[model samples]
Target chain A: MSIKLEHLNYIYSQGTAYEKQALRDVCLELRDGEFVGLIGHTGSGKSTLIQHLNGLVRATSGALYVDGKNIYDSSYNMKGLRAKVGLVFQYPEYQLFEVNVLKDVCFGPKNQGLTDEEAEERAKKALAQVGIDENCYEQSPFDLSGGQKRRAAIAGVLAMEPEVLVLDEPTAGLDPRGRLEILGLISRLHRERRITVVLVSHSMEDVAEYVERIIVMNKGSVMLDGTPKEVFAHDKELEQVGLAVPQVTYLMRGLSELGIPVRRDVTTVEEAREEIRRLLKRRETCGQAAEGQ
Target chain B: MLRDITLGQYYPADSVIHKLDPRLKLIGTMVFLVSLFLSHDWIGYLAATVFLAGVIRASRVPFRYMLKGLKAIILILLITVVFNLFVVPGDVIWEFWVLRVTRQGLSQAGFMAVRLIYLIIGSSVMTLTTTPNDLTDGLERVLGPLRMVKVPVHEIAMIMSIALRFIPILLEETDKIMKAQTARGADFESGNLIQKAKSMVPLLVPLFISAFRRANDLALAMEARCYRGGAGRTKMKPLLYEKRDYAGYAVLAVYLAAMIAIRIMR
Candidate 1:
């Protein structure tokens, strides 16, 4: 489903001493089946914006339209939107309360009014999608390691079969391998299921490597929104907001500054490797021509 | 949703009551609570109302905000009112099947409600004006004499203060867990009593887990910092009775005397 936010603003503790505008006139639209990256530091309105999509948080002002329907209106069914737009919160494993992993994953589908058999069936498929083995299905979710618990939690949201998945910092506090595994799993789901995915994260490398469209927020406003290549081009501006471009982008820049002509927007090690190889080939050819002279 | 709870919250304002020594506030709250119970008639209640109104104004805490704490006890207030309006024996005002409304009952219920309301507001004023750290220091100092009798006074105060600090945090955590479950379509509302209780399983399990995790982390952190049961601990800002504290005590003593005198007049 397509999602559109028009001049959306959200203020926490409104009219109180602790009043804060968490979002300021953010306007954006996401087309169907888009892979989008929401980049921001902590408290940069990224989480607040996604929460609005599912109606978990209402915008303080402005309009949010999900698939052409105004969400904040009284007549709209918020539960339906929430079911369609599954949000996997940060540290979702803490929400696990079922006796077993499979049962926990089935909670969402059952809540969608599915029959027990159908709910279990959907839960099984979701568990498999997240690479959770059957052996772990009957075990207590608390018994699993951190990464496994995270996957089980994701499966809970996946079982709801949402058209759009919004994950807020899914790989936070995980080790490197676990982080890559979770990211890879999410990307695979997006590729296979063709669901619209909005990944909110602080890691520039992950966003650069995975998503096509990048939206960066700073101080409760959309600072930049474009393709990853376009956004990273303004790395200096990102730095001023306490954000940075991908490590590979810096590596490419360093290579270019050292007299090697390389593409500076390369975001992955593989892309950097190709750029370095191309530079080396040109250097060797130049040396041979000079020797011939 | 849970973020809205302002219980035990300190309102930062520069005011005379806010500047009072926390120990004095604590003692004053106790004195006020006792006086509220001792208050027998409308005169004592009036003295209470005047005293409470003055303190609340001095603290600069919003009146509407203080009333928010009353929301949680509305049911108890109603029940007390009902019981007091029917149960006490006196000249009957109204009669019905298995229930008799009496003058004494009505008056008793009215006094009970007033007393409870005053008790809550008086204590809330104390907490609202004092920061948790100051309260902790105040508690440790006031309860210091208990240490001579082999009581773990510092530890008790530390635990109380920590529990106070965690109230808002745990509420936020509970809210998060509730929202997580709600997103999964777990209906917390629109359920029968049993069903509502059952639905809370989803909320409470996560809350407990996170609470334990936080407690574990805190214990480790405290131990890492060589927190050895508060022994030999010296305060950076030791508790000292300012002239304001003495002045506060004088005001409280006068208020208490008025309360007792009003009770005698009735």
Candidate 2:
């Protein structure tokens, strides 16, 4: 297993009047090189769970083992673990603070104890990988566009060369174009770099298009974990938890209800396009065969 | 994890104290605070303690929460006790290098600690019972006379209330920034003092940026809603005193009288 959580429970402000049970006995094991999409409504413990993977938030009652080491154990070096599992927080642009874009991206590699040359090299490669222009490197990170700033922030984490990358709502609060740019960059990074990615998002379409495995969270527990095709099949149950499958999935299901022989498991536009094309070709062949008869 | 701060935080509940007029509650708290320092003997402290306990029980806020406020002040309490112990010259009981513990110092230290405790608890009870909104309203009303001196009392109260409301939001933002930095291998705990201070640069820079953004958004929102100033602005729920407020004042008067009587008898 790459990351393991056993009966993880986290209660915010425990024993106080404002005590809130944010996570409740969550047990999950993520294997190596798995692209997992964690989907949930607000306050469903999705952020809290990803924080545990990198040891940012400790499990209140249970054990979390990252790469075969119990993170909460006293002897375990959490700093090394943090470097091993990079987390890009929500609105990551807000976390970009260095004077220049290049320097900001170098923060992670430098913090990981890399020498100046090596850190600079890693930062440059990560920035290039995220498609930030070289001319923008010397400009202040605060001066970058929203999407560029977000990319720079991601590059900061990418520079750390983490084994597993966890991002929370990476495309939130962006325009359609900016959203596509950032998500495409992340998808490319996952595809080419083969980094294990855990994307915590509310956008079912984004999750459906990208991830192989989907974990549905509700009320601080994992309600469902399966392939996107399987998880999105429980449309009514997901709706009860204030969530839903992708719009394309709903469209395919609607087409089937209208007496079209379309597959309901279709999630992405490409998948729906292929299925509809196949259905039309089958009809054309059946009509030709009937005429031949 | 930073959200556990209950200091000066209002505890929502239905009780006699919660129902009293904010103006009366503010004035009562002031009187109680002043009366805490009026007594020099143990009898005075005892009377103050009894009055506070009675008010706390009436407020219906958990005593445990009130005491939790004391946790944040433990260092200040210790410093005051220690400073008072070593500085006050009197009948010396114990002496060391540059430090003297005297009978008067001991008694005075105890008095100071109790006075400080009573002060904190009294103010905490007031704040716990009254919300930031009501407190601002009460402050503006109580300081209305200062407007004649061109003090901008309403604006000041508005600023105070706004700052109070943003404290928790900023703290949560700060916690998020800290976690983001930590996830990037920023070491906040294991560093030396200087290293720790330097590490905070990452957290603070982001927090300040977000705070400014939030403030800008809030200002735009207020302006868009046509919020000009407090001039000629009337409260939606204007402050009004019911019979219970008068009764609360009468009880406060009796408590103050008991405190004065105890001081005089000693």
Candidate 3:
């Protein structure tokens, strides 16, 4: 279930005037059950790097291994690899083409050569996993609302039951509530399925809240790889690369600079609130000691 | 798979041919193709060849590219040449068991090959120099007079424009769908013919679905903007016959007349 890339380099439109070196030599790995957040500015090779995981875009020169199998090996089965590493593209709903929702969600499982009955069962379960009602199964996918379409598209991949789920900006273009719902669904899937989740996003706050580990990319290379707290500690360097620490982390750092005795590593509002409460209690005890003296 | 297609491919450059009015270039290509067919002898072919060479040089499109375009149709060109050489009865210059090579046959084959080559080179010059949008605009302007015969010239032009616009978008969509299926372990390459065709089902299903979706969206978008199809539609950039265009037409007319005169003389 783990994915590894060794010395990956990608050059787009190779040998053409439009040739762009999208990814430099980069090495990274994601183990099973780890929710890794990949953050980078636009054109920082974040998309190119993730696309390599499933062999969507083969590395111009490098090696990619999934579950101890060399993906680029001539003997490897690409279609099977794709089934194992399910990549939900950005705005995947655009890829939906079936007349109805059920058929569309069954597309992947059907391609995997499952019996029609088996595929239908998988599709139903997958639709449920993504929180889509069974009543909507017979309706046209096109008739669904934007958020529902997004969910159905995700369920289409989930139907394949991939061990490694790589999502590219899954929450993009959604309203605030829809964004939260999708993120919650993703977190639940990661927890219940124990799937390796690689979420590519630009929002530091979203990554900080959900992902246990963060890999920051800058200009086609890995800039930092650590826990959210460890990565956010280099706020200045992150800012230099057009990235920023989470707002809560920023606020904590600011309070620490003013001698507020708050920890600068807090990346969420709840943690910040608890830290402030603890500091206030300590201050009260110190004030009592001064009065007693 | 779709990305490999080079249709509407424009090589960006600052050459003189690139600066010429697209309408003029389109007409020039038609005139050049006609001359290639009208030429009856080596003298005529040589004259056309020199003229084509001049156009190619001015356009600044690499000669190798014109050759590449011809390479795509090499089989058809070869068939034409062979058919003319072997099938046409004439005074035999060389004879084999079932093969006869004659002076007239050789000449006809040579002329046909030259004509086919010139036709490809002439049109490729137009594509290489002009962008797809400008080429469609030029086509609409050139065919505007067909409206007198009740032909839907404007509508056809609009369709052409839309089709051209969708080419790149469809190509990009195809690339995305192919990659998606490939990620799912759909083997597109290294399979037997049946396997290959089977693999295409996933790619095609997604591609066709996206294409229809795009078309539906585009239609809705057009309707939202009150697009009423070619009726009383005003152009943002109206087509005007400039002095350069007239001069280009004059040159083409002279070339056509000269080719006709050569045919008659022959």
Query: What Cα-based lDDT does every candidate model obtain?
Result: 0.91, 0.90, 0.85
lDDT of 2: 0.90
Q: Which regions of candidate 2 deviate over 4 angstroms? A: A287-293, B71-75
Considering the two chains of model 3, state its CAPRI-style docking category: acceptable
Give the per-residue lDDT digits (tens) of candidate 2, residues B1-266.
45546655778888989888989989998999899889998888888888889999998888877776677788999999999999899999999888899999999999999988888788889888889899999999999999999999989999989987887688889888988998998878887899989988998898888889999999999999899888888879989889998898899889888888888878
Could you say which candidate leads in TM-score?
1
Q: Give the Å error, residue B75, model 1.
A: 2.0
Per-residue CA lDDT of candidate 3, range A1-293, in tens?
78888999999877655678999989998998999999999999998898998887889998988888889999998778778889998888877767899988888898798999999999999999999998999999989998999999999999999999999999999998899889999999999999999999999978888999999999998999999989998999999999999999888888889987888889988899999999999999999999999
Ranking by lDDT: 1, 2, 3
Residue-by-residue lDDT tens digits, candidate 1, B1-266: 45545668877788999999999999999999999888788888888899899999988888867777777778999999998898899999999999999989989999999887777778778888899899999999988899999999999999988998999889888888888888888888887999999988999988998999999999999999999998899999998999989999999999998888888777
Fraction of native contacts (fnat) of each candidate: 0.78, 0.84, 0.48
Docking class of 2: medium
Sorted on TM-score, best first, the list reads 1, 2, 3
* CAPRI docking class of candidate 1: high
Task: Show what share of the native A-B interface contacts model 1 retains.
Answer: 0.78
**What would the TM-scores of all predictions be?**
0.97, 0.95, 0.82
* Model 1 alpha-carbon drift over 4 Å, by segment: A289-293
Please, what are the lDDT tens digits per residue for candidate 2 over residues A1-293? 38888999999877655789999999999888889999999999999899988888877899998777888999999888989899999999998989999999999999989998999999999999999999999999999998899999999999999889899999999999998898888888889888899999998988888898999999999999999999998999999999999999899999999999899889899999999999999999999999999
Candidate 1 matches the true fold with a TM-score of 0.97
Which window of 10 residues has the lowest lDDT sum in candidate 1 chain B?
B1-10
